[model samples]
Target: MLEDKKDGWKAAIALAPAMIFLVVFMFFPLVNTTIMSFMEGFQFRANAGIFAISHRYQGIGFQEYINVLRDPIFLTALKNTMVMVVISVPISVILGLLVSVCLNNIKRLQNIFQTIFFLPYVTNTIALGMVFKVMFSTNNGLINLIVETFGGDKIAWLTDATTKGYWSALFVITCYTVWSGLAFKILVFLSGLQSIDKQYYEAARIDGASRARVFWKITVPLLSPMIAYITITSFIGAFKAYESVIAVFGRGSYIFGPAGDTNMWITVVGYVYKLLPSLMTPGNLSKASAGSVILLLIILAFTGIQLYVSKKRVHY
Candidate 1:
């Protein structure tokens, strides 16, 4: 019994660091944030600097959540973010899978091509976002310069409205998003492809199957798991799409153009930034917390749906 107890204690000691990290870094903050969501005000002024302070209350109710739902800007941000995900995520995944398949078949200089394609994955976003902003700039940008070379008028890639009363921020965001995202998708697909059995392809060829037939029949079924994994991750990453948009187009202003004062490109996360200072007001903080809670629920819903559909599709 003593020996068994000692072994258990040793195992607990070994796990202590990781447990501590989870408690402090993840669980603790999550619990605190959830509590804050229920609280009235964001900041409180106490009576004294040290031990002579009292905690006062200024509580809010469901009105905060009601305000978020009624806000037109919040709805616009949601629409814009959904538009980006619809365009960028699937294209990125499909292109990545295609490139990974092609690269896997290459017999020479494979490492060089892989490294070249993978370069963007490791690059600093702040610097890359700036470069992309310049490239996509409406005036004197490289892309605009190229258009002028072809006798075309300069186009405002970052600022143009796609449709009347619609923001075209997705175009500029999709450009950089597709560029930086390819590397991650490629690596993931390559790993999945590597796990596929070469014998399956050989057997299919022996049966007089075409390359396309073999890929459809064998490759895709086996790769569905990887595809699902990448899809979920890509969905999650869509929320982080603000950096490039903000870099190309300044924050707190209209999204599409100077004339397009629609506030179309403000994502839910960006709304948090937009409403931060107003958080001092007891009322607004509750609304902001409600927004945060909505975002969390939306993400969870997306993840849950993906998991449900993907599980149904998985063969083994």
Candidate 2:
């Protein structure tokens, strides 16, 4: 009993730093944000001491939440984010799995191939987004040059939002998201594939199973746990997508149409960012907090659903 108690105390001491860090950075901020979300009237005032400022809060309720839900820009942002998540997650997962399988099958230069595929995952996202932006630029872009070489017109891929609406921006963002996201998924899947027992493959081959049949019957079921993990994480990452848009479009940029500004390709994170500055005025703090809470709930709900489904379907 004494030894066990001593070990328990040591474990608690070892975990203290991490627990403290979480409380300070994560738990406290979440609690503060939730409290702020219910507040309505907020005012900043200078204290008697110079360089000292204080805030006053009033009216605790759900009005801020209502305002955020009703805001057209927030609604559009939600729709665009959902569209991005729906499109990018599956495509990225599929591409990652295929690439992993290919890499796993190849014995020669496998490390080089794995490193090359994973470079994008390690590279800075903003830099990758900027690189993509230049590649998809309206004039003299590599893609456009190829198109023109084939006697096709150059496309205003990013700027032509005036005619194409959200799609123009969506295409570029989705492509970048999938490309940048592929490396990690591939790495995970490749690891999972390697860990799978080769005896299963041998058995399938002895049974004269086709490559497709082996993959579906042996590979996929074995990989389902990794697949479930990747799917949940990718979905969450897609929902929080923000930097790619900032790197592609200027800050606070909106999608345009012939009629004028049509929509913003801003994700939920982007919407939260847009509202953050207004918090200084003590007016939109609640709104911003409410938006953050909404995003949190959304992520939680989606994660819950994924976990529930994975329970039913994941082989492991």
Candidate 3:
């Protein structure tokens, strides 16, 4: 018992630094944010290199959450984020699976192909967004040039607000998101595919299984765990998309409609970012915190659902 106690003490000592870091950084912030979410009109005061809530406007209620849910801008951001998550995640997963399967089959120059595909994953997101913006520019973009070469009129790929009454910007953003997210999914799927038993494929081949059947029956079921993981993570990432919007459309840029009214291509994170400045005052701090809490809950709920579904569907 004394030896076990000594070992336990050593283990605790070893973990002390990491535990302190998490408490100071992650846990504290999460707790503070949750507390702020329930508060209204709370102000922050800085003192001696630390910040504390001022008691001037302490309101403990759900009004902030109600306001967040009712605010049109927040609602729009929620809709856009949902649309992005729904559209981009499935497309990315499908493309990743297909490409990974192809890559798995190609033995010659496999490393080179893997490197080329993974380049996007390592590339700077802002730089890639800039490149995409340039390519989709309405005035002198490569896409417009190609269209002009084919005797077609220039199309406003990024700047278009309403084609008939729908937000065209959503489509552009969705496409960009799917393209950007492909590399990571492909890498994970390829790794999972390689780890799968080759004997399964051999058995399928001996049974005269067609390529499609073999993939559906053997590869997909075996790859279900990776698929579930990728899907959950991709969905969360898509829901929090903000950088691409900032890169393609400058910060605070808006999509102008035919009636001259404007709509910002803001995601949930973007909405929170916009609201963060208001936290300096007693006006919107609680509201911003409420939005953040909503976002956190959404991510948690989705993750839980994915986990539950995976338990039923995933094989090992």
Top candidate when judged by lDDT against the true structure? 2
Per-residue CA lDDT of candidate 2, range 1-316, in tens?
9999999999999999999999888987898788778877544455632111235667878999999999988998898889999999999999999999999999999999999999998898778877887888879778889989999988877776464746877888888889888998998999999999999899999999999999898899999999999999999999898877776654333322212453457677777776664524334667888999999999999999999999999985
C-alpha lDDT (0 to 100) for residue 208 of candidate 2: 100
Best by the TM-score measure:
2
- In order of lDDT, best first, we have 2, 3, 1
Clashing pairs in 2: none
Between candidates 2 and 3, the one scoring higher on lDDT is: 2
Worst 10 residues of 3 by lDDT: 252-261
Q: lDDT of each prediction vs. the true structure? A: 0.74, 0.82, 0.79
Candidate 3 Cα misplacement greater than 4 A, ranges? 48-55, 163-167, 251-262, 278-283
Tens digit per residue, CA lDDT, model 1, 216-308 = 878888999999999999998885456656655644322423345535567777775566554343345445667778787888899999999
Residue 127 of model 2, lDDT score: 80
Which whole-number lDDT from 0 to 100 does residue 119 have in model 1? 94
Candidate 1 runs further than 4 Å off:
1-11, 46-57, 161-168, 250-262, 278-284
Q: How much is the lDDT of residue 129 in candidate 1?
A: 72
Model 3, 1-316: lDDT tens digits are: 9999999999999999999999999888888788788878756655523333433446688988999999999998898788878888898899999999999999899999988888878999878877877887889999889989999988877665555323556666766787788888988999899999899999999999999999999999999999999999998898788876766654343332222334456778777776765434334667778998999999999999999989999997
Error of 3 at 210 (Å): 0.7
